[model samples]
Target: MFNGLSFEKLLLVGVIAVFLLGPDKLPSYAAKLGRLVRTLRDYANGAKVRMKEEMGPEFDDVDWKKLDPRQYDPRRIIREALLDDAPAAAVPVIKPVSRPEPAYLSRQKDAVPSQAHDDSATPFDSEST
Candidate 1:
């Protein structure tokens, strides 16, 4: 059965097909279409059988509708994960231990004169401009 097509729509399509193909070619085309449908059905069934063989008894237990990719929604999944009943374990908060300043920094601070108290003019390079 067509997913949404009514009998009227199908009849219209059939009428158009008959007009397009004419009486001479319609039977052969119809036979080809039937064969194609049969082949597709066989392929689907073969796949299902192969899956059953590979999966063993678990194949029957699987919820096919639930496993369908069309049901997948990232938003719904994220929301469900967020709304899960069990609370997550609290992470331990660690206060960082105070460390002594590095020797190089202390030495640099002592070596560099404070700019607020310094009266020297900054050197400018005229040629580099």
Candidate 2:
């Protein structure tokens, strides 16, 4: 957007900033700025790498040769996911059976003696003799 700005205009901006911050502080300030920029660039590159890893090989399938920045809305890519006629994808629909109660259930439930069921007398007992 600032392509029309002349070299003189950039020189003026640099002069003003140097005057405001002073010459001695500029080198140290520039070193810190360079480090900050490197950190941010590294962070962005790491994120891009991680996204490529997570998305698999298809992540690099960008058509850089034909990419149009103006039409790059993410929502446009998923526009058909919510369609009314979206296909009913095939799946194994397990039919649950209403199982009848086992005939021995009542007998098993009443068989455990109260004295033999004391929690302190088992191998996990806290009150072992």
Candidate 3:
């Protein structure tokens, strides 16, 4: 079932194949392709049958569309989780604990003198410049 291929595209591919393979060998190649498709179909059917046997009757009841990985959207899942109808009171409130500043940061702050109120010109190192 070439669902993705348009009629024009199929025609173009067939024309190209005819030119490349020639009319003499085309029939044999087409037969081989048909057999390959048939074999693949049989293999898929066998796998399905094996899965059905291993899973039992519940396999028939399974929501295959719902189980599809393509149907999962992380954004939708997170939104659903965030908008769940659990009572606000039941949710624990996390309070941020006041922590003492790190020793290095405290020392740095202590080392730097406040210059906000100072009107004096800043001293510059001529050698560094």
Candidate 4:
């Protein structure tokens, strides 16, 4: 049931645990860990039971997989968003319109000759004015 952890990683963890705990304490520690896991599992089941009791019959109808954060991936979300069952001809394509230059910039262009326009004059510099 370990989703992300591979067999090699789990084996490495077990080997490290054996080396750190030693042969004498390993069995006792393993027993304690199993008990701890059992206790946590019991707590989770109790919480689920309590939630079902509080939420009534509606909790049974709830979509747990859809609500789960791990169920969503970037690829899945993008795929869902881009999905269109209709024909391509039915979809309208929008063309961008070219906007005219602002009044000040237009006036500046008309007042200044193309050849006389100084390329070295920086727009933002206080010395330019």
Clashes of each: 0, 0, 0, 0
lDDT of 3 by residue, 56-87 (tens): 99999999999899989999999999999876
lDDT of 4 at 113: 80
Root mean square deviation (Cα) for candidate 1: 8.6
Instruction: Estimate TM-scores for all models.
Output: 0.68, 0.45, 0.62, 0.51
If the candidates were sorted by their TM-score against the true structure, best first, what order would they fall in? 1, 3, 4, 2
Q: Clashes in model 4: which pairs? A: none
Q: List residue ranges in candidate 3 displaced over 4 A.
A: 1-3, 85-129
- Find the number of clashing residue pairs for candidate 1: 0
Q: Candidate 1 vs candidate 3: which has greater TM-score?
A: 1
Please give the lDDT score at residue 45 for candidate 1. 99
lDDT of 1 by residue, 1-129 (tens): 368998999899999999999999999999999999999999999999999999999999999998889889999999999999897899999999786776545665677476333436564443354
| lDDT of candidate 4 over 1-129, digit per residue (tens) | 679899999999999999999999999999999999999999999999999999999999999988988877999788876896566666677898776666546666677585455766655433344
Could you tell me the lDDT of residue 1 within candidate 1? 36
How displaced is residue 116 in candidate 3, in Å? 48
Candidate 2 C-alpha error for residue 59, in Å: 1.0
Q: What's the CA RMSD for each of the models?
A: 8.6, 11.3, 11.0, 9.3
Please provide, for model 2 over 1-129, each residue's C-alpha lDDT reduced to its tens digit, 9 standing for 90 to 100.
Answer: 798899999899889989999999999988998999999999999999998999898888977556777766668656755564766879999999786555445444676675334445434322342
Candidate with top TM-score is: 1
* Residue 126 lDDT in candidate 3: 38
